[model samples]
Target: MGDDDVLATLARERGRALFGYAYLLTGQAHAAEDLVQEALVRTFARRRVGFTPDSAEAYVRRAILSTFLDDARRRQRWSGVRHLLGRHDEPARDPAPAVGAVLDVRAALATLAPQERAAAVLRWCEDLTVPEVAARMGLAVGTVKRYLSTAGHKLEALLGPLPDDETVPLTSGRTRP
Candidate 1:
């Protein structure tokens, strides 16, 4: 199959899983879609000699992880620089659906260190094993476990009580009650 054909097939087959993974990693719908799109574009933008179509999905996923982590680091650095500049500005507009059952959960997730949040998402939401998460994140397995544990503790404090397993659904595709 041609490169485009291969990518299309992968999207059709794994789009939902990919989207869910992005959303959990990102905690934002629009950003998640953008991340997925960017990953796809980067994956197919150019195919290397050893990059087989069968490995495209894995490649896109690795790209997504890289992109998300890089963004988190960039934002952290920018936040510090902006602080030095005394540019403490609030968001210009309120978030849509400002109140919902999942808002607390999302807010709580947002408070986590980026890597910790990523570890929790990969383990619980994406249902990946610790070793799998470590491999995806290019970290040692022990570090992944530590992140997951730290995230679990913080989430429990913010959420009151939560399951050790993945209790929170990745997406909140419903009207606020």
Candidate 2:
């Protein structure tokens, strides 16, 4: 398909799902929508990534993730500059109580370093295997495994223990604690 055609089809077929994933990462409706649209332009129109139709969604998902992380880092740097200039905003309010565990998990996920968060989300949320996540994130399998390990400990520290079913799988050369 041509660039516009491919983007049109992806938006028609996967738009809601893509927006939902972006929303989970960003926690804002307008930002989520904009992120998905931006990802489409970068992935398809710009041809920044080579892809087959079968892998298009995965590629786009990675684009969304990378874009989100990039924006986050940019915002953090800008915030630091503002702080240095003696500007401050009031502390933000906590999430509504009704949102509870999901929000807590999201908050915990935010506390993680980027690589750990990406590894944990891909392995546990996206249900990718170690080797698969390694390929997706362009890291070695051992590195992915270590990221999962560090993310697990960090998450457990922040949120306490997870249920057995929620635990990440140990790598082949590793054993569970």
Candidate 3:
């Protein structure tokens, strides 16, 4: 098949799944779609370099992740202005409890150092294994474990125990919320 044919076929098969991956990372549907579309466009443009089928998916996924992270950093830099201009439309579902819970978690998370926060989020929120988290964050296994432990201790002090039904899994250990 020609390069265009191959790229089209890959997009036809993997586009939705790629968008879903982006959505998982971003927690925003429109942003995820935009990220995925941009990644695909970049991939198509680079097809002249002869990307293989197996590597194409990984390439696009990495691009999407990098794009999402870059956008997050940019948004953080301009968040004050964005918040001032943004609408206050709430989610379709009642997000009060969820928002409160997330805010609480975020507040507690902010107490930890950057590496600790990244370790905890990767282990708990992303449900990645310790090795996987270490690989992604480019930290040693021991360092990741230490960060998790430190983060867990701080969270425990800040948030206290969870209710019987609510469970929180941190990098170091799991706690009942």
TM-score winner among the candidates? 1
Displacement of the residue 66 alpha carbon in candidate 1, Å? 0.5
Instruction: Tell me model 2's lDDT, rounded to 2 decimals.
Output: 0.83
Candidate 1 clashing pairs, residues 3+ apart or interchain: none
The list of candidate 2 runs beyond 4 A from truth reads 48-52, 86-177
Which 10 consecutive positions of candidate 2 have the poorest summed lDDT?
168-177
Pick by TM-score: 2 or 3, better one: 2
Ranking of all predicted structures according to TM-score, beginning with the best and ending with the worst: 1, 2, 3
lDDT of 2 by residue, 17-128 (tens): 9999999999999999999988877777656344555467787899999999999999999987886765357665577773797788899999999999999988777767
Q: Which ranges of candidate 3 are over 4 A from the true structure?
A: 80-177
Q: Which one wins by TM-score: 1 or 3? A: 1
Residue-level lDDT tens digits of model 1 in 98-135 = 56646887898999999999998787667777898999
What would the C-alpha RMSD of candidate 1 be, to one decimal place? 23.8
Q: Rate residue 167 of model 3 by lDDT.
A: 52
The CA-based lDDT of model 3 is what? 0.79
Model 3: per-residue lDDT, tens digit, 1-177? 566776687788887889899989988899888999898787677545656655788888988988888888888888767667656685466779978988899999988899999988887777677898899999899999899888878888888853322354433454423
